[model samples]
Target chain A: MDGHGGRERQLFELGRLVKAGLTQPLGLMRPGGVGRILAVRSGEGDVERGLLEMGFVEGACVEVLHHGFLGRDPLAVRINQAMTVALRRGEANAVLVGPLLNRATDVEPTTDQESRPS
Target chain B: MTAGTLAAEGFRPARIALVGPPNSGKTTLFNTLTGGRQKTANYPGVTVERKSGLLKTPGGHPVEVLDLPGSYSLRARSPDEAITRDVVLGRQARETLPDALVCVTDATNLGQHLRLLLELRQLGRPLILVLNMMDIAQKRGCQISTEALSRQLGIPVVTTVAMRKHGVRDLLGQIDALLNQAPAGDGVTAISDWVEPSPDAIRAHHREVERLLQEAVVREGAPEHLTRQLDRVLLHPVAGPLILLALLFLMFQAVFSWAEAPMDWIDGGMAGLQQWLSAHMEESLLKSLLVDGIVAGVGGVVIFLPQILILFLFILLLEDSGYMTRAAFLMDRLMSAVGLNGRAFIPLLSSFACAIPGIMAARTIAHPLDRLVTILIAPLMTCSARLPVYVLLIAAFVPATTVWGGIGLQGLVMFGLYATGIVGALAVAGVLRLTLLRGDRQPLLMELPSYKWPNPANVLLGLWERAKIFMRRIGTIILSVLVILWFLSTFPAAPEGATEPAIYYSFAGLIGRTLEPLLAPIGFNWQIAIALVPGLAAREVAVAALGTVYALSGDEGAVTEALTTTLAQSWTLATALSLLAWYVFAPQCLATLAAVRRETNSWRWAAFMFVYLMTLAYLAAFVTYRVALALGGG
Candidate 1:
């Protein structure tokens, strides 16, 4: 799948669909690719501050640490160090991200590939 | 020393900490258990404070009941929960480990409330489960078998209706029985195993608890009646906000209208007492000190007690009715847009009555940064203390011109001042979030409790507690500051040939004169400058200080009348507006500063807060003064 689009593919569309907790997306692996933080959506004012204070800022580095059962919200992420924080799916959905950097073999194939335009 | 060490020291009383979710009736339980016989004071050493009271067990032995901040679980999230965890685990430095734990859980919400119970059970303490709000549960057609729950949990279970004092005797009996049992030793059971266990383990525990609950609990549908009808209108998107605004307007009007008579009585009483003291006693400095220094100064602030009490009564009623959480929910969306979390609404709302408790209440927010941000901005909300100054200024200067039919111009101005504070807080929070505490927004996940009629007793007790605290401040801190201010405005008798009063030669006059240049940009005269010094103790103290300073500045016979007339004659509307603006943001209360220090546990943050707030106040006042002056007001 590497450069299969012959240099015409968008950088934002390169992440694999891995089964992980939706709520805690920060620690979930984007095996073989790096992702960019797109936006944060939260209903509460303080929660946004909390996410930012905890280093879940826009344009910050985030990597998946572990996945919980059935790809729910509890995903661990490595923002800077090996340290991880568990977030719920409701909270994780508020954080929008783009494609990850570099692909890994251990990652599952993207399930939403059909939805992505070539 | 660790809390465990403190517990081991053996000098401290055996501590019994009450932990529960908010709206679980923990405070009502605390009040019922302690009654008015107990001493209610802040926790020693730290500001993440606990309310401790004395409770006598059925066996007639005394036990210290420490009402810890209400929390949903043992998970150390907010400062309030952190305090509960530390105190329970014997980890907090200044607090001792609770010898016994009373977990108050609302019966109506058993599944959710049980999580905390389970967490507390794993702590291996001698824990007792108090099923609070049983009356509400019964009203909702909920049935709980206490015996079955006790058997399931292997702990004593007591049902209590704290508001009406129902089942309290039985609950006390259970506490006595537990206290007689041997204390648990040093082995602390790990709670992580329960929550982060293997999938099978988690499933098994869940199944077991479910089965236990199935057998022990029976609940019908929630009652649908007046509360639902009220909430329908109160929680409407448009009507809710309108009602809130209307309620607030009425509350302010009540604070002014209802308090006027008592205030007059207090004022008259103080004047008569002062006169009597001066007449009966021999002419001595001590006599002058007693009447002029103590009576005149403190009395001025004490007269405002009725207003403060009335304001607090409304707040307590609102809180007790369980409508506060709904208001928070309604406000969350608006607050989030302005960089404040929804949880900030309660604390800020509470600040309208007094910033001290409002700042203290910030512990409920789960995020530290969010709580700190709320605490830092709370003082800007224009507490009840500022009302007297605002009222005095408005009554003296602002013409009584109605805007629309039946809408008092004075009330409109009061509303405008409050709106200004709210706007200022939002602006500051937004700036701080963008520049300093820049971070992602946290999601607001708060439980909205079913509404209930506020227990009259609890409301009365809350009002009484606030009234007492206000009185104590007036008696001690305000009293002391007033005496000092009086002395400063007195002494240094005027020269024999001088036409001016003795106060002109006093230290306050000299100090005020020196401060004139610094305050001139804000259009404050020397007397106002002198008043601002004592105002640092409390915002309302400025009003009293003004009364005393002006009283001592001239003839005593017509002080109050002369002072009001002098203010009207000397001060312009722009000056009043500028001063009001200054107070809207000024970090004036020592109590609030002390609380911030206690909450943050760092002097750096406190100092930073002081400097930033003072700068804001000065700049705001200066701008207002200049703008008003350009408009030809002063």
Candidate 2:
């Protein structure tokens, strides 16, 4: 049940190469790109609560909604739905993520989907 | 615990608890209500102390005001909040429940602040609502009808601007009115009955409150245009972080730039006092005790007053102007990455002053693990005590060279030290989160208030309180430790005609010698080993201890020279650098460790904290020392 598309598979492979500590992947992550939750390096509690609270639970989707212009630390992430959260790059790297395929339609829909057309 | 036991023993006094959310001007109101008649001491049985002051109601009835920690609701997570919950519920073993509660809420931020009020209301305690910071609401073009709010809440509502001291008379009048209303011939209501309403119920309550607010309160317009404009710049995606960094940089710079003159003045004054005592008094043990013990030891700690004051000045101003939350929001991402909650920003920031209060401040962090982790790691954050040593080292050694165009090299080093603490704290938090206290990361939910002008009174009061606390420590803990160190250094009067300084013959010297081998791997010499003994009382005491040790080890000429020059001549650059690194992670503050023990109520956690910190300190020092030596800097 590999969920990644071909492009995502390529990015996942790339992420694997870069995944050493939290220092690599400098050139890979970009603002507005969707990413898959590859793995969570830290356990639950405040850190996990923080992640879940910010909507970064395991297997959930996330997108780099914004980036700082200068330092690579501060980042704004949009988790599943339209929930936007700001984080420092140091914090963002803790959540291991692989690139997502078909980022074009990743924009969160405004209305609840309970009654959406099938 | 003590209060309740004493009360049970028939020492009961009419008790009143001050309760409010963060940023509701609760502390300010507490200060006003209690004034100088207050005493701050440990709570009976629990290390979480209660601050109480005696006040007389307008009817001249005596009342004891207990300033409970600011808490948002009864769903307690942090120890401080738990204390509040326990005290209010009469659950604490040592303290009795308050006879009545004063629920303080921000007049302007009623929408969110009132949730706590609603929760407190459910506690069924006889409570009065104090609408604090009323002036701010008025300035923000918010008009709240006091009578209507009182009617809706079924509690007497009195408006107060705590900062300005306005509405105190009316508040006292209200308190008198409430006091006269006999307690319905029934005891205090049980807080457990206030199980927070279900989400749907809460939402309905909110809607009802909103409707009431619409009828009773009128907003002239949106908040002030200036506040919005300031927020636009302060909270900007691109600019917010930069501004925060710039503000922090300036704050550090100001600590050095502003405090230099005052610090020198204080140093000179101490030296003058020493000289006067030497000239006028006989060469008796008393004279030596006063001069060597009190002057040297206490003087060392007192010099840090300026730095502490300056640091707190920035904190107070930031808090007053309502930018502290914005700073937290800006840093949330970074904090989360390091396995810390964004709510930890305030507590971590508080550590710069002292870890005790900082640990206490962790009460605001909503997650138990987050709060615990924060309390454990807070001591590593380079508190004010370490500043004196840092300033001395940077002044004596690090060349005043500018990098990045115009930034002062000394200032940059200071900034680096601060960053090192932050980094180390994060690393520790990361490890702890992944290992011992693994759990889900708490969401970083925070309220960002509209920016406002920092009240001068609050800033001044904050500085005054910090200054007084620092001075008190100097007069008490540091002073006692210094005097003891002085005695240990001066006693068994150096063997007659000994070439070495008299101190080497004393107990301190023998102990230092014995400990030197253990510390040698980290570049600490015999003298530093000796200093470490007293350093446990407070980190900065090590600096003074070193000063006294070196002064005793040499002649008048040596005593006059700066401590750094002496170090530079005696030790290698690597040794000095390693010492700096060690201080960054040093488990030297007993008070902090004691605080951790008290907060966690577990000796195992306390021991773990000590071992972990000492290990990090040694490793950091070992690497730095060895690397520096390898670089041929010695």
Tell me the tens digit of each residue's lDDT in model 2 across B1-634: 3323333344555688899877788878888888767676766545555688987666665778898887766666456777888888878766766877888888865655676677778777778888898886676556778888788778888899897779988887776666566452255444455453443334444455555666567442123345545755776777988899899879877977898899888888888888899899999999989877787667766777787778778888998888887787777767777778767888898787677667866766767898889988998787888876787777777888998999999988887888899888998999999999998766454544556688775587567766665566556656666677777877778876887666667888888889899899988888888777778677877776777667643322244356768876787778888888998988887667766877777878888999998899999999999998899967
Task: Report the lDDT of model 1 for residue A88.
Answer: 44
iRMSD computed for candidate 1 = 18.2
DockQ of each: 0.03, 0.05
TM-score of chain B of each: 0.86, 0.86
Worst 10 residues of 1 chain A by lDDT: A109-118
Question: Docking quality tier of candidate 2?
Answer: incorrect
TM-score per candidate, in order? Answer: 0.77, 0.77
Interface RMSD for each candidate model?
Answer: 18.2, 10.6
